[model samples]
Target: MTKKNLLLTILATSVIAVFAIIALMPFFFLFISSFKAGSEMIRNGLQFKFDFQNYNLANYALIKTERDGIYLKWYLNSIIIMIIQVGAGLFFSSLVGYGLAKYKFRGRNIIFILVLMVMMVPVEILILPLYKEINSFKMIDTYAGVVLPFIVPATGIFFFRQFCSGLPTEIMESGRIDGCSEFGIFFKLMMPIMLPAYGAMTILLAMGSWNSMVWPMIVLRTSEMQTLPIGLQSLLTPYGNNYDLLLSGAVMSVIPIMIIFLLNQKTFIAGMSAGSVKG
Candidate 1:
């Protein structure tokens, strides 16, 4: 490569590195602050200065012994809900998307348009009606209530539709010629080819479900049923805040998302690139 191109590449890399560091700064502050006592943290606030005297494992230890380890219960609840949301989201959303992408049927364009319209409408606008529906079904404070409304996300459907549109339809025709059922073709043939899409969607769906607060808070009435975000927010009240458990728990809550992103990092980029260009 020419020196001009090389210089440009270096400059671009430097800029990206700076932005990445800026993005990570909050998590860095949260990690270090979790080691300090509540009073010290409030007094000192988030700072670059590292004082060994102010730091301890007390916050983390409190997570284990405090309130009979209710923090762990919250963590488990979030995990279960995330799992259900991601699995169901992928299954139903992809089915709808694949049908729209590959099938020639009436009202297909109208259905896709409807999906886009729903995507444009913010979730906040639907919350009231969703809550009422959940209440009517007597699913309040249950996992179903938390996971049902958003199981087939409009965004997921749009994404999968775009990706599947670029796929060759010959394979699908071949499956039919082999006497495979429609479900068999989708599950066995198309699904394997859609792995990159699945990987990308898995991370997206997991993050959405894990970080969800408002919906779960509305649906769950009991403390034991609360997800991590709700549980952490509960630490803050009009009287005082429990920074001790709050900071440490928040830091730990980030672990699962980081692990998921790392695992799917390769497929994520590919899937995103292909989807962007395809449709």
Candidate 2:
């Protein structure tokens, strides 16, 4: 290679590395600040220090929230919602995606187009209508109300459709010849082979559900039904700042996602990359 070309490559790589660090430095700071005391919040803002023992683990202990405001309840709600969303949404999406990719049927193209249109439709637009519907059904202020709206996502279907498009068609045919029913083929073969897809979809759905604020807030008006994201908002009362509790809650919220991503990072990237290449 030419010397100038080599030098440019090194320079470009260094710049990207610097930028990546700059991007991630805040998360590092956030995690560390979670361990800091109220004084640390006042001193250097979010990026200060590493005094790990500033707060004890017991400080964030599960307490029965006065007037049904338990952090543990909210934590459980978020976790349950995450599981339901990730599990059911991924299941239905993958089934639909595989059917679309493999089956030849009437109005197939039109159906695919409809799926795309659904993806294009914004989530905000449905809030008012959904609210009215939930109100009618009396799901308001319940876990079902908190979770049911999230049971569906066009984005998940679109993503799975894209991923499923790249799989070998003959494998599905082979399953059919082996006396497998369509449902059998999906569970026995397609779902298993699509582990990478599942990992990616799980992370995405979980994070979206876990971080959801507006929809959960709307349907779950009662504090008892609050998810972690909405519950954390309560930590900041009107009168004064509660930085320590806020940061602790933030840490608790962030840790689940952080751990999930770290565990599945490689497969997650592979599945995400599959979208463009496979589609």
Candidate 3:
């Protein structure tokens, strides 16, 4: 290869390597801090050390037994909420998006416009109204309150709509000719076709729902109903701090998201690229 091209290749590789380190630095610190004793962490401030003797599984163990295993309870709550939210969100949001994209119905354009408008409005702004509505239904401090409001996310609807818009209507027409019911066609045919879209949305929605703190903080009044993020924050007390448990719990909290991304990495990338091109 020409020297100019070789130089550019080396430069690009170096830049990427540097940015990768920058991105991973926080995680490295988190892992390292998780291993350090609270006293050592306070003294060293997130530094790497080879003090294996000082590092123990005590923090993790304490987290497990603390307050009747509340950490595990919170983790399970997050997992359950994420599963239900993603399942319901994907089905309802995609169904709405599909109809908006492909069907000719009265008020469809207006509904799509409303979805777009909702997307533009910040969630923080709607929190008050949503909380009031949930309270009116006597759903406060309940899982339903947490999951229901976000089950049909505007962004998910918009994304699926854009993705579905690029899909061929011929498929649907063919299904109709084959005597397939519309719901059957959607579930059997369209869902498989939109797998990549589902993958992308799954990761996004999973991450958001798993890490969601604000809305949950406002809605869930009981400690047992709390998710991981809020549970982690509750580790800190006015009288004393539980840095070791907090740090170790923080490290563990990242595992589910990493697993989700790794599972859907290829499909997620393809979906994102396809969505961008189609959009």
Candidate 4:
């Protein structure tokens, strides 16, 4: 490469490295603080210095044992909710998106327009009516209540629609010529074709469901049904706070997200790039 090109590349790399450090600083401090005693944390405020004497596994152990291992229960609840939401969201939303993208039926454009409109509206604005609807159905404090409202996300539909729009209709015609059913073509043919899209949506849906707090908090009145976000908030009391358990639990809660990203890194990147260009 020319000298000018080499300099530009080095400059870009340095800028990215600097931003990466800035982005990761908070997480580094969170991990470090999780190891420190509450007193030490209060005194030092996420200092870089590591005092081996002040660090212990007591925080993690306490989290595991606290309230008869309710933290595990909350973690499990979040996992179950994430799985159900991602599965249902992918299946139903993608189907709707595909139909909207490929089929020409009465009111198809109207439905797509409505989906777009819903996407523009903030979730916070709909919370009141949604809570009332859930309450009327007597589904409050149940897992269904938490997972149902988000199962067919507008954002997922829009994403899948854009992705599907770029796919060839010839494949569907080929499947029809082979005497395959519509659902079969979708499940067996299109699903594999849309793996990247699924990967991208999986991360988005999983993260949203896992980190959801306000809606779950509103619907789930019982402590046992609470997800990690709500459960973590409960760690703070008016009398005293469990900073060690709080910070440690927060660190542990991030594990599944990191694992998801690591597993789908390639597909996710491809899906995002393709979707952006196609959309």
TM-score on alpha carbons, each prediction: 0.90, 0.81, 0.87, 0.89
> What are the runs in model 2 whose C-alpha is more than 4 Å off?
1-16, 35-69, 266-279
lDDT of 4 by residue, 29-136 (tens): 888778766556666677667667867777888677878888898999999988899899988989999888888899999999999999999888989999999999
lDDT of each: 0.89, 0.75, 0.85, 0.85
Give the candidate number with the greatest TM-score: 1
Please tell me which predicted candidate would have the highest lDDT against the true structure. 1
**lDDT by residue for model 1 over 1-279, one digit each (tens)?**
699999999999999999999999999988988888766667766777988786889899978887899999999999999888999999999999999998989999999999999999988898999999999999999999999999789999999999899787877888999999998989988887888888999998999999999999999999999999999999865333377899899999999888988998887676334422233
Better of 2 and 4 by TM-score: 4
Residue 152 deviation, candidate 2, in Å? 2.7
Candidate 3 lDDT: 0.85
lDDT of 2 by residue, 1-279 (tens): 699999999999999999999998867776666655545567666654456655464324423432343777888888877877778888788888878887889988898899889888776899999999989999998767767776766778778788888777776787889989989988987776687888888888888988988888788887767898888887766333355556667777787877878887777566333322232
Q: Is candidate 1 or candidate 4 better by TM-score?
A: 1
Q: Show pairs that collide, candidate 1.
A: none
Q: Residue 41 in candidate 1 has what lDDT?
A: 65
